[model samples]
Target: MDATPPGWPEAVRPPGAPDWERTAVAWLFDLVPPDYRAHEVLRRYPVLLARFARDHVAAGLEAARSGWRTVRVELADHLPADAMAAAMTAYEREGARLAAAARGVAVVSAALRGERWVPRL
Candidate 1:
């Protein structure tokens, strides 16, 4: 795992747990569209976040799981592979954008909690 440098920003860590990146990614993925994300992306996020946490800011895994569950419910009827693929591509792009925004929110939340900031190396 990558170590946080001394005096890093508190926003680097997520609220309510030490595994901040997992929590943050989970939270960010929640904002994504349900149909595209539930099946195509949800399964991959945990592993991806695990790697991300090793190298970057912390995230929220529970939030991601909840988002996946909601997405699955929203898209109960599965679509053809072609349509699913297209939708998933769009969702991934949007999800990345949303993740960045969520990161900002995580940072702010950390500050509100009075946690120390740690920069990702």
Candidate 2:
């Protein structure tokens, strides 16, 4: 456990939470797509918000039980050994997929809520 929270923005720390960073981080991974723009998702996809929350929380709990180390090992085994560029490309694509999903959720949420001023990502 980190004594001092790392890579946490001062803004997102919940008020009166003892472990704000941990709380926020767990929120990001466990909740609907943890990012600064997630608030936008809340604004747009009003209908799916409950579903996303339920599924995401379940996934988070399962991931915690399984542990990250095992997941990392599985990911490593699937990477291309011969072509470094291909491996990098695959890595980038997967990251983009996650980002796109987050963006989609945010955009849909915002539209549903009829939000006017969405902050720039």
Candidate 2 colliding pairs:
41-106, 43-109, 43-110, 44-108, 44-109, 44-110, 44-111, 45-108, 45-109, 45-110
**Residues 67-89, candidate 2, lDDT per residue (tens digit)?**
43254455666656655445555
Name the candidate that leads on TM-score.
Answer: 2
Model 1 C-alpha lDDT per residue in residues 1-121, reported as the tens digit of each score:
3343333344445444576655555553444344534564444554443333333332343344445446545664776667655665655655565465545554434443455565655
Output the TM-score of candidate 1.
0.29
lDDT of 1: 0.47
Against the true structure, what is every candidate's RMSD? 13.7, 13.7
Number of colliding residue pairs in each model = 21, 10
Best candidate according to lDDT: 1
